[model samples]
Target chain A: MTVAIQLGIIVGYLLLALAIGLVAYRLTDRTAEDFYLASRTVGTIVLLFTTFATLLSAFTFFAGPNVAYEQGPEWVLVMGLMDGIIFAILWYVIGYKQWLLGRQYEYVTLGEMLGDRFASRRLRGLVAGVSLLWLFPYVMLQQVGAGTALQALTEGTVPYAVGAGLITAFMILYVVVAGFRGIAWTDTLQGAFMLVTTWIALVWVLAVVGGPSAASSALEAEAAHHLALGSDFYTVQWMLSTAITIGFGVAMFPQVNQRFFAAGSKKVLKRSFALWPLLCVLLFVPSFLLGAWARGLDVAIPEGENVLPVILAEYTPVWFAALVIAGAMAAMMSSSDSMLLSGSSYFTRDLYRPFVDTDLSARREDLLARIGVVGFATASFLASLWNPATLFELGDAAFSGFAQLALPVMVALYWRKTTRAGITAGILASQVFYLSSLFTSIVPSTYAGWTAGLVGMGLGLVVTVAVSLLTTPAPDERRAIYFDGLEAD
Target chain B: MSRPALWGWIAVAIGLSALTIPWFLWGDATLVAGVPLWLWWHVGWMGLASLVFWLFARRFWGLGIESDSDSSGGSPGSGSRVDAGGERR
Candidate 1:
């Protein structure tokens, strides 16, 4: 009976999400921007929540608590405190410039602006390709979260394969029916539910297992290491590198970049970012703490990502557990749908139209983008079947991949002297070094305490600067398109 | 310096320090509010970041005050007034 209630809530939530998509479809127009970016018409509240929901992926909802449950409360510093601030600054730095340039160029994708600025179509295609390589795994991370959650929630009755398939189908339907507008609305709804339920779960768990003071005392007595931050893994270097990689990686995410274009105005973007840290506080604090608290309550988390469901099922009531599970689903779906949408946009705009179908019309472009959404989601669904890695491991790999792009993209955006050759060389050097570390043993995963991704970013920056000085400059007209503003340092 | 530009640099300065400063050097034994001093220290910086970004947005980016008036027609290389500063006047 309890399982039935929980499954019913999840199905009902999915139906509600579908209904919102249908409504958004009715409101949507046939233009490319309308389909892809909500015609750049998102307002402040929706903008804020959608960005919030999208960034707070299943990694946070599931893996975060699991990390806390296994490692200690120190995960809070990595997941909550550092990321809140780091990502906020990144959004401020990256979003402001991207929004300004996006407005001026009517750019629907990051590649469009970067390519046009350098007058290099290959640069455009490379950016999209790099995004796809990293983003595919991240999308699979969401599928992995959903499947794991259902398998655990229903005690393996549903199975991971069924869970993955269900989410992919719903996400494809949502994006195809409503596009960007539907995504924004459903994200807002799901984002709110996620925040509220997370807090409720935290409070309920704390109350069930004794309050913070009692829980902390119990933790200290039984597992003192969980309360402290100087463990072998939580060293000064690892914490800082984790924060830096996740922070900068978040800024370069294509889905996040697209949000900058969708904002109705600078006010909407600014307001959203301004409140971002507080949002992080509300969500991450309770979520991670609950995971840590589970230790005091003697909850057995067989798998780290299963921490949320494990705790709620053992301690909380049936109906409340259902709501919290639904929220976790919301976190996964909200993130997954946006990623699918962004991936399709990248493929259609950067690769297909430019290379495959040079004369593709707006109508065909829209159709192709929708097809790309299904394709990307299907690929990720299959990828999730391997159950490749733990949620945190998958998220970390994806975050590191995107972080390497941050340096090149930042340099290209602000520095007019950044040539097409320079940016390309920087990205190539970064990816080669970074990938070599992950795949081979050419460089130790952590060399002299810095992560491979950080090393790649550092090398990429150096190579870009060196190559730009060596290469012929982009024409003055191309430079002016990106830099012709009244501000100077 | 423009109000926003000054705050922009300040934001970056604070941000770099928050990420770079060795908070983990603090001993894990000292707990504040049930969290280790090192963790609490980072939380303090998170609060500081929120304040810094709010200031940057209001004074530097001119968030609420600035609106994209020519959004529909402001394609780059065209004659629209939209520029990197994000101001029309």
Candidate 2:
């Protein structure tokens, strides 16, 4: 019965999303600009919800809460407080700058922007290749989360492969059907689902444990250490590094960076970011509280499984658990859908059209992006079934890898002397150091109280600046590609 | 927003971000109303961040992107129907 209700709610939600996606597609102008960026006219409300949904994925639903449950609630500060402010700042620094350039050049992808500015096909290929590389793990992470959550919610009634495949199939349909227009519409729905259900889940769980005071006392008695700071796990370094990695990394995610171009006007972008920190607070608090409070309850979480489903199933009513789990599925779908959509743009526009066929027509390019969506989603679904690493591990590596690109991209945007070689070298060197953390211990993942990604980001910034100063400027004609029209009023 | 004022707000944002992690309360596990004091600090600090961001939004919404573009690019965000590598008309 529980499985039936869960399946029913989930299937119903998916159908509603599909219908919405199909309807949103009617608004598409069939032009590349309209398809990829919704004609760059997205307003404030939809923009906020889509971005919120896109950013809060399985990590927010499963990994973040699990961290709070097992370790402590200090995970909140890293994600909620630190990342919130940092990302708002980055949305301005990196995103706004990109928005300016994107407006002038009508750029749809970072690869397009960077590659054009430097006048290097290799740089375009490099930027697109790096994004797709890191994005693969993130896509796989979403699939894994979806499959695992469903499996847990239904108590194995729904197989992991089936759950993962279901979302993949649905994503391909909707993403190919509507593009960013469809995506923004469904993301608004999913974002609301996530926020509403997470808050209700917290309240439900907290009520079951009596109340905040009682739960706090229970934690104090059973897990007093969770309430306090000074632990090695939630240390200043761990919190700071994790926050920095995820915060900076987000701006470089193709899906998000693309939204920087999709904003209708600067007002839309400014309003969305201005409200971002508060939104983070709303969703994160309840989600983390569920995990932290679960530690005080009688929830039995087997090793390597997410604590959220277990808490929902054991504590909340069966119907409510099913609803919230569907909400978790909502979070994962919103995230993966955006990933596949933007990844398609990267693959089709940045890689295929540029390298494979410069003369590729817009209609064919659009068709290829649809095909890319199906292909990429299938690969991720298969990888989820394989389930290589834990959620946190995969998520962290992806974050660190993405973080390496942010600084180089920033330099390309703001600095006039930025050379192709300098940006390329910076990205490559930083990623080399970052990737070493996983495969080898020589370059520790965290050193001197900094994450490998944080240190790597710093390293990339330094290399980019130093190399830019050392390299000769691009010729005037080439420089005019980006810098020609800029003068303050 | 003027150049100096924009930079000043950026500095203020930086200051708030630096203090967000509760460096002072690392060892202090004091709970207010059964919630961790540090967590409470985050809640309050977030309100301040929103205010700062809101104020910044109201003042510097333009980020100077509107007035700085070259006239050759047509108009800003017209979705100029050109390829990324194609020349801006």
Candidate 3:
């Protein structure tokens, strides 16, 4: 496959996605519900695939192989498989509760859930602010991945800026015109391509490396540290940290929360949750195996990051190579669309409507959301042009900040007596702690900074709960406003 | 509180986490594709977790089990309006 053919295939895929979005637009009214949640009509299958696609982005596809290459076998043990289990548990324990609440309230975004639960406009605003901030870096990561793919497949024929711009332009147009409905429908298609690409690459890589049995034997005979799990203590600590970061952080991600709200019903959400893990195997497992096999083949590449995909492109036939390239592109675009859509929704529904103009009509709000989507996509695309030195590090830092939301948001959901003062204090405390840890020398590393942030959040929650109980309770009517229609009988 | 359900989920989660941990795969095994069987244990654990989640969602949270009441229309105490009077009544 020449660079020209690869570019053509990617361009075709983008056009097909845009057409799907346009079709969805014609089928549904351009109202807030339709723009935000596809009128909450997403069935179990669409929801399931979209959720899976959104979660497993270019980061998983590109970085999983790199991590496996560097960390030896422990990468799969500590990060790969453990992360999946964490997601499952998170879905069962926290996500189910969120789904039930989202259905009950018809929540549009995560900020709405926080505001309604804690009864604090400021807290809601704070959440919206954080969401918008974190989404920029995340969207930038996808753009960088897209740039990498274009550069690799084109053999540097196209410049990085041009590649990123084209991808971002296509995404912005599709999203602004179609909204969540457009993104979800396109994700369903992209998700299918990703699964097929992954399976094919896995089998082809294994065959080239002389099958799984031969590959394993070759790896075992390597240097002493080849298959070792590294330091036991470090491995356990890394695994635990990775699990917590991904489990709680991913659950709190604005895009994932948006998906929770988009499900047509609790049943749809739950069924989707059940089916997503199966899809994850097809998406994740093969990358680890392929990366390990590449290492055994002694493909000398750049250390840390550039090893896995480069090896694949170097070793595999042009046709299979094109498929892998397509898969990587699929991963990047699927995630980028969801992030752009979620960020735009936060800006329109959470930030703009309530604070800027409480009386903005539904029609005006929908228009504003479309405009916001374009603006955010443009800004994120510009940011992606910087081509940050460390994509995974930036992602980890952003997720750590997102994790700070867990305590305040969770308490507000289940704790009826949560006070506004506590919620505000909690958000401030967590943000301050996280920002300080991030910028200063206080925390030694990313994990430590996350620990400090979690501690601050914990303390803030204690104060919020304690003070609310001691202070005069919010008016019963006010409490009932949140409880709305739930029955006690 | 549903202790059985809660504890069951906790136990299963812990068991799955343990399965992914490399302690069980400590013994020397032939490496396949430059990865030991122990390493593949992690993949197996993830696969199982995914399977369990799928099953739980299908069996317990499916739309088929839900009551098909027409609750889309506003119900009593829908609370769309914050207050009836000019005051916060």
Candidate 4:
């Protein structure tokens, strides 16, 4: 009986999301900018929520709490505190600059902006390539999470592939029909749902277990290490590297990067970033505390399963657990839909428009972008069925891959001297080093103290600085694109 | 902000980031209200970081991104207008 009502509610919620997409499609203009960027009129609340939803994926819903449940609450250090604040700082340093340039040039995609600056189609393709390569796994991870959540929520009544496929189909439809406008609206809805439902779950769990002190007392008795940050697994080096990697990685996400351009005004952008850390605390504090408290409450989390659904089922009423699990589904779908939109933008703008047909019309381009969404989402769905790595593993790999691009990107934005060759070297060398660490044992994945991703970022920065100083920018390459308000030529 | 002033902010960012890591709290096992001291430290640090960021964002925004003759730069397509310093005019 509980499963049926829970399933019914979840289905209704999914339909509501589709309805929002349909309405967005009705309201949105068919132009490339409107389809991909909402005509750059996204307000502060929508921008904040969309970026927040896009950044917090199945990783937040599943892996984060699971990690805390197993290792300790120290995952909060890596995520809630460190990543939450650092990403906001980078948003100003990188995102604000990107937004300014986006408005000036009317740029809708990261590759379009960077490629235009260098006058290099290859550079555009490279940026698109890097984003797509790392982004697809993340898309797949969302499905993996959705599948895991549904299977757990339904008590294995819904198969994993079916659960994964369902979200993928819905995401493709939402993205193709509504584009950025629809995706952003749904993201706002999903963001609110995730926050509220998660808090309810946390509150219910605490009520059942007798609050924070009780959870803490349980941890002190059985899992004392869970309360502290200096454990072997939560070492300073590991926490910092993880936070650095994820934080910069989120900053470079094509979906999140695209949001920088979508903001309605500078004030909206500024307010969103300023309040970002506080927003993070609202969700993550509950998530980490719930996971930590589950130890005290004697919730037995299954191997390879998320701690969230388990705790929800054990502590909360069945209908409430279903609702919250659906909320987790909300997080996953919100993330996947945004990924599809951005991935399509990367395809149609960077790859299709540039390489395949330079003279394509805006309408034709929009059509192709829709097709691109279908293809990317389908590919991700198929990838989800193949091998099916853990959520944390896939998410971490993608985040690290994206993190490699952060330094060169920031340098390109803030420094007028940054050259195309410099950016190219930075992107290529860093990616190669990071990939080698992943695939081969010839180079240790962790060298000295930092992870391969951070090392790759450092290496990229060095190469970018050295090569940019050594080489001269094109005579026609203008300075105002990057440094407009400055007094310098 | 001047170049040196910008660099000063960068230095401050690094210093604050260094403090956030809690490397020095290796042996501290003190727990307040069932939560470890480190977690509380983070809550405090995050509060400080956000406050500082809010101030920096307010004071130093649009430093080089806004300009009265922004369109005058030789880029193929770009546009903006601004005061002598880069706030809305």
Candidate 5:
């Protein structure tokens, strides 16, 4: 009976999500821009919540608590407070320029704007290629989270493969039918649900663990190391690097970049970002605290992603457990749909339309985007079923890859001397060094507190600047058109 | 939204990150309001971040007067087809 109830709750939530997609479909126009970009009509509340929910992915739902469970409360520093501030700044820094350029050129994808700016179709393709490469793992992270959450919630009755398959199928349909408008609406709902339920879970856990004072004392007695940042893993250098990489990565994620263009107005975008840190605190602090409290309660969590389920199932009521699991699944699905949409946009708009057929009609382009969505989701789902690595490891690798692009992007936007060759070289150097560090032992992933990704970013910056000085600048016409009205009055 | 003001916020963000995360300050055996001192310190900073971001957003973002540009090549002096705010003419 309990298992059935839990599964029913999850199914009900998924259905509600699909219904929103249908409503979005009815409202959507036939244009490719409407399908992929939601006609650029998203308001402040929807924009804030969609961006918020998309940013809080399965990794935050699963891996965040896992780290806190293993390390201590300091995990909050990495994703919660530090990340919150860093990302708010980045949104202002990177997103403002992106929005201006996107509006000026009526661009539907970042690649389109970038290619035009550099007068290099190859550079555009490279950006899309790099984004797709890293995005694959992140898309798979959601499948893994959904599959594991269902399997655990049903006590293995549903199975991991089935759980993952259900999410992928639903998300593909959702993205295909609803487009960006539906995504924003559903994300707002799911984001609010997850945030509220997480707080409720926190309060419930504090009560069950004999109150906040007792929980704190229990942790201090049992796991004092988790309380501080001096642990081997939480070295100053490691913390700084992790925060920097993830901050930059969040700003560069294609889905997030696209959201900058979805804002109905600049005021809407600014208001959303202004409130972002508060939302981060509300969502992340509770999850980390729940993890720390698990240590106090002596929960045995071999897999960190299982922290939420194991604790909720054991300590809380059956209904509460089911609701929380549904919320976690919501976080995973919301993130997955956005990634699928963005990845397909990159493939269809950036790669396919440009290289294969320059004259593809808007209707045909929409069809191709839907096809790309299915293809990409299937690939990611298959990868998730293989279960190659833990969520934390895969997420870290993917984030580092995106972080490497952040510097090049900033330079391309703000620096007029940035040449196509210099930007291309910068991206290549970063990827080569970063990818090599992952596979080989010649360089450690982290040494003296700096991550390979951070080192790669530094190298990429130096190479980019040097190559720019050595190469000829972009055409005077190109520079003038790109930067013409972008300056603040 | 002057260049120096923008740089100031960046400095504050980095400085706060450095001061908040290291073990020398809030990492010890202290608890406030039944939470670790470090955890509370972060909570405090989240508030500060909200304020700073709000101020930055109002003054700095999207301040340029909207201009019209054609879809053709984004070339300057082309006939205007849409304004800078991204709306169609």
Candidate 6:
């Protein structure tokens, strides 16, 4: 369990991932659809695993256990578990509808769908801009997680900067060369590896700690208060906040939307959605229980994160530790590639192709997307070197920022009376409120950002509806103007 | 909308979740992970609620349907099919 050996194992895994990426690149053609949507032919099984892998990122794998370790078996674990379930249900109820529309419209990005739905290029630009801004910090957090895991596993032998740099290089090279096909195929392999390793770690830990019953008894004896449910008021608020935050945010994320569009048919997409939740339950519950067991053992973890993985390495045997490290790395790399691809696609399709040059060919668009992938990966890697104050805080901020767009976007899509003027006003109002909440400590609670964002969203909807009703509807001749160039297929 | 079934399911989900939030199960047992068993019951209920919602929605809401025509760029016999390079032909 020396630092050198741990570093060696991590490096080997990175190389293996890169090799997988290169093979996928060879299989992928140099076309806009292939590069962006995997030629819209991804099957059910691949889609299911890729979706699962992308959703279960470093935050869930590494930071979730840390939360359980620190907070015991209190509301935090309940909140986290509830968030995952909510997201799965949201995907079925609402997210699948959007996927069907994505297929119908041949949409490769959320911005594309919005532009088509609203019939406004300006709205598309605004959506793309806000998405890029929200996703940057999320991508940066993944880089930080990879670097921190490397540093911990290697006992600081691999410095944060070097660790981040190595992973970034791999991500950039893989994404730039392979695109969506590369990310999806590698994600399938990595997702399987992580699932197996997680079970192995859980079983080994349970056996070593004298089984789940002993662990449960020990944890109960140590911190009886952390095990109880909060009052009805607290549970209701906790459930509502979690359900809204994750339910809305996951469905709206640009990367996930891209996956929805990539599936070949609505049937394939639906099947993937049906199968994904089972994998999530298997992946999430064990980690939460492990954290609970740690609490019972009275193990002291670091403050503000870097706690769970560190504890795993310290307590587990060398082989099991290596497997856990591999799983964490797999989660990090799988998510990072998808995020980088989505961010790059936003700039290439929505920002560059539409405004910068309308005559740009598909080939040129693909090239720009590849270049954007490299640039984004490099920037996030540098940010990771600075070292974040905390992982969960950064993640929560990103989630709240993206959740602000949910109401306006959904309203515009399903409600014909929603006006362009209203969407503009809503975007500006929500961004201002969200930014103010971030900079000023006006909100007293940790989730104040979400509350403020929701308030702004509500105001924006009112303004949009009022303005649309006041102004005359677009003329009948102009009705074709909105639907122009749009084919239902 | 003919999807009253969908609405009915959503109500059931909300009701079930509400029921689980009260700690009605852990009467005399001491707490497990620092909280009483009733709290664990609540979390369990939330998790169950999520599962039920997902299953019912997918089964009744057409949430899992995939239209191959959308990907192939044509209706069932319109002569469009994917080639080796993934282009519609």
TM-score of chain A of each: 0.97, 0.96, 0.91, 0.97, 0.97, 0.90
Q: Judge the docking of candidate 3 as incorrect, acceptable, medium or high.
A: incorrect
lDDT of 5 at A134: 94
Model 5, position A335, has a per-residue lDDT of 88
TM-score each candidate.
0.91, 0.93, 0.87, 0.93, 0.93, 0.85
lDDT of 5 by residue, A79-191 (tens): 86446877777776777677766776888777788788888889889999999999998999889888887877787898999988988998998998888899989999999
DockQ of each: 0.23, 0.30, 0.22, 0.28, 0.32, 0.14
Question: Which CAPRI quality tier does the interface of model 2 achieve?
Answer: acceptable
Query: What is the TM-score (0 to 1) of candidate 3?
Result: 0.87
lDDT of 3 by residue, A1-489 (tens): 477667777777777887898898787686876788887778777887788788877777777777666555465555544346666666655565555556667778888877776566776788899877777888888888888768767878887888888888888887778778878888888788878877777787777777877766665555345565555433555666665656567777878767776666555655566565456655666777677556667667764446656766776766667767776787788888888888888888788887989998889888888788788888888887766557777777677677777767666655667777666666677777777877889844445423554455565567667666776654421454444343211
Show the colliding residue pairs in model 2. A485-B70
**Model 5 chain A lDDT-worst window of ten:** A480-489
lDDT of 4 by residue, A326-378 (tens): 88788888888888889989999999888999999999988988999999999
True contacts kept of 3: 0.40
RMSD vs true structure, all candidates:
4.8, 4.7, 6.5, 4.0, 4.7, 5.6
Whichever of 1 and 6 has more TM-score, that candidate is 1
Task: Return the top candidate by DockQ.
Answer: 5
Q: What is the lDDT of residue A408 in candidate 1?
A: 85
Q: On a 0 to 100 scale, what is the lDDT of residue A60 in model 4?
A: 87
* lDDT for model 5: 0.81
Worst 10 residues of 1 chain A by lDDT: A480-489
Best by lDDT: 2
Residue runs of model 2 more than 4 Å from their true location after superposition: A480-489, B1-3, B63-89
Question: Evaluated on chain B only, what are the TM-scores of all the candidate structures, in order?
Answer: 0.46, 0.65, 0.54, 0.66, 0.55, 0.45
Question: Against the unseen true structure, what C-alpha lDDT does each candidate score?
Answer: 0.78, 0.81, 0.68, 0.81, 0.81, 0.67
After superposition, candidate 3 runs with Cα above 4 Å error: A78-83, A221-226, A230-234, A303-305, A446-473, A476-489, B26-35, B54-89
If both were scored by DockQ, which would come out higher, candidate 1 or candidate 4?
Answer: 4
Put down candidate 1 lDDT per residue, A293-384, tens digits, no spaces: 77777766673447778788888899998898889889888998999999999999998878888898988888888989989999989988
